[model samples]
Target: MADKIFRNGEIVDGSGKARFKADLAVEGDTIVAIGDLKDMQAPEIIDISGKVICPGFIDMHSHTDMSIAYIPEADSLLHQGITTAVTGHCGESPVPVTNHNRSYFRNPDEIKDIDLPWERLETMGGFLGFLEEIGTSLNITPIVGQGAIRSAVVGFSAERPTEDQMEAMQQLVEQAMDEGAIGISTGLIYPPGSYASTEELIEVTKPVGRRGGIYFSHIRDEGDKLIEATKEEIEIGRKTGAAIHHSHFKAAGRDNWEKAEPALRLIDQAVAEGLQMTSDMYPYTAGATGLVALLPEWAQEGGLGDIVKRLSDKATRLKMVASMKTEGFFSIAEWDKVLIAGSSNPAYSGKYISELAETSGKTPYDWIFDALLETRGQIGMILFMMSEENVKMQFNRPYMMVGTDASGMLFEGPFAQGAHPRAMGTFPRFLGKYVRDEKVLPLEEAIHRISGLPAWKLNFKDRGLIRRGYKADLVVFDPATILDKADFINPFQKPVGIDYVLVNGQTVVKFNVHTHARPGVITTH
Candidate 1:
């Protein structure tokens, strides 16, 4: 007898094949049987007639690890039918902690009220062990962040690494790979990681390539230099032999909207040349990041303390503003398009830069500097820079996959600040709007991108499919009613029609409500 059986559902097995009616059985944490399981007896049987049964969605890119310690239940993600997440993305992870880089481990402003044991979770192995000990709501495949690794060895200096330092960095990558990291991720636009030269990136990624791990990167620039950045990423992959993945792939800013297709062609050319290349994007047009990203890279050097000190000086502040204006930073002509996604000050939360500036009788630059100082450089901003047409076009591409690029949050909690709607509604939005309504791609292909495609990319052998003997991570939803309700004004709203979700054969969501189950595990390549 099986532990449970799901009967009468239309199965889309995450293989991009047509759906078919079937009954699936699960015993313990694995799917024991499939096809006609009506003859089998089980302790519990679920009749999911008329519902679509598919493999649980795998978020190709996420930063959930940053807050998973506090919100272990992962309410927002479970509600959207995500059973696994590729975390530690965009060159940010909570590991490789040392005396020289302890302060840079966690963003103090992002996490509050919870006491985390930083010492015990210092290295990649230690962090994975801690997650196993405490349990999580979704399986996490952690990518060792290059930024954290660089900071651990060389602090935040922009100076080139010494030969000894380079060797030490390579050793860290090897250690992380040995400790179950799937790959090394880089936020090339951010500090520390951004400071690295192309040669340094190729050298560091050599170990990951040798170990069959992917090199995921948020490229240096997504605006005027989008094509060049894509080429740079391809060169790193060509030199290191590592599979390359572009994180949150986008051509940002109004002036660069037409660059999307050309940048993607660069990826296709690389793929044709036999280099493994892929990219992921969220459904929304706007992108979110720290407000500090507004400053010139020079001003963003060192730590938060250094940045705050510089912002306090009137002369330096004016110089930074002038540089931003001259460079047309982020290709912005209007400050109204920039909204505060998160802030330590409630007054600034959910408001646009232009609105706040106008109300205070200050210029946008002055208001921005004041806000950063008031919050100690802990503000988050959302820039509406991408074209909607480009977003739809990208999703239609065969190599493009979906990712939230946002952290998990609950409706009512400290974690529920002003967040991008993607955090709570990425998968459903992609399915409901793009696939079901707009007909961007066939339903089967859309499901595959969120499931099998990402799983195959990460080399997950057992999950991301509905085969007998595979791990029984699944989701059952109504195709017609599935839709994402979360928006910029109310990001905490959950999606509808996600009837049931299972993680490792245990029900984590039933009737669209979380069961608070912690059956998730730490997955590795």
Candidate 2:
């Protein structure tokens, strides 16, 4: 007898094959049987007669590490049918915290409500242990963050690491891999990680290659330097032999919209050359990041205190503004396209830079500087820069997978304030808008991209497919009615038509309502 059985559902299997009617049984945390199981007996039976059952969606790239400690329920993620999340993305992780980098490990303003167990999270092993102790709502696959490693050893300095420092960094990477991290990640556009030269990156990633771990990167540039950045990533893979996965691959800015095709061609060429290369993307034209990204790189160095000092200096502020103008900050014509997504002050939430600047009777740069200073550089902004045509083009690629690039959050409390719609709607929006409405991809192929492709890339042994011995992580949804309701203005709304979500054979979501079950485990490579 099985614990529960899903009957009369069309199974997609996350294999890119045609769907077929099947009855699936789950016992404990694993799928016990699949196929014609008319005689199967279970204490609980779900009649999913009109729904499609598929492997739970895997988020290929995410920053859930930053918020999982606070939002362990992961309501937004579970509601969207995400079963496993590959976190520590874009060069940020909570592990390997050292005295030198302790203050910078996580933003204090973001976690003012709860106390984190810092001592239990200083290492990858300890972090994983802590997660298990707390229990999460979805399986978490953590990766070592290059930025955090650099911060721990190099302390956010742009100066090249000493030979001893470089060795220390390598040791940290090795330690993380040994502690069950799947691979290493770099946020090349962020500080500390961005300060590393290409040679430094190749050197640091050597241990990952030796361990057969992947090297995931949010490349150095996404605008005017798109092609060059892509080439740099390839060079790192070529030199280090580490499998490469680009995070939230995009060509930002109006001038670089067409660069998406060429940049992807580089990936194709690299693949042809035998360098393992893949990419993930969210189904959105706009992207969200810290407002401080608008500042010049030099101005972003050091810690928050140093950055505040620089912002306080009028001469330095003027120089920064000039540099941003010259480099095309935000890469859009009007500041209105840049909306305030998150901030310490709620008044700024949901307002655009243009509106705030106009109301304050100040220049856009001045308003930004004032906002950053007032919030102490803790503001988040959503930039509307990418082209929808390019987004659809990327979605049609065979090598591309889907990622939310947003953290899990509930629809209430501090977590919901100014959250990106992608946090709650990426999967449904991709399935609803792209696959169902526009026909960008067949449902079978699209399901594979979100499930099987990521699972294979991450080398998951049994998950990501609805196989008889695999972990019982599954979702059942109505193909015709599934649609994302979250939008830029009202990002708190949940999607509709997802009927059930099971994590580890336990129902975490039923009919779009959270069951508050924390059955997720720390999945390691």
Error of 1 at 208 (Å): 0.7
lDDT per residue (tens digit) for residues 498-525 in model 1: 9999999999999878899999999895
Q: How accurate locally, in lDDT, is each candidate?
A: 0.89, 0.90
Quantify how close model 1 is to the true structure by its C-alpha RMSD in Å.
Answer: 1.3
Per-residue CA lDDT of model 2 for 348-380, tens digit only, reads 989999999999999999999899999998899
Candidate 2's displacement at residue 298, Å, is: 0.7
Off by over 4 Å in 1: 106-112
Clash count for each candidate, listed in order shown: 0, 0
Model 1 — TM-score against the truth? 0.98
**Every model's TM-score:** 0.98, 0.98
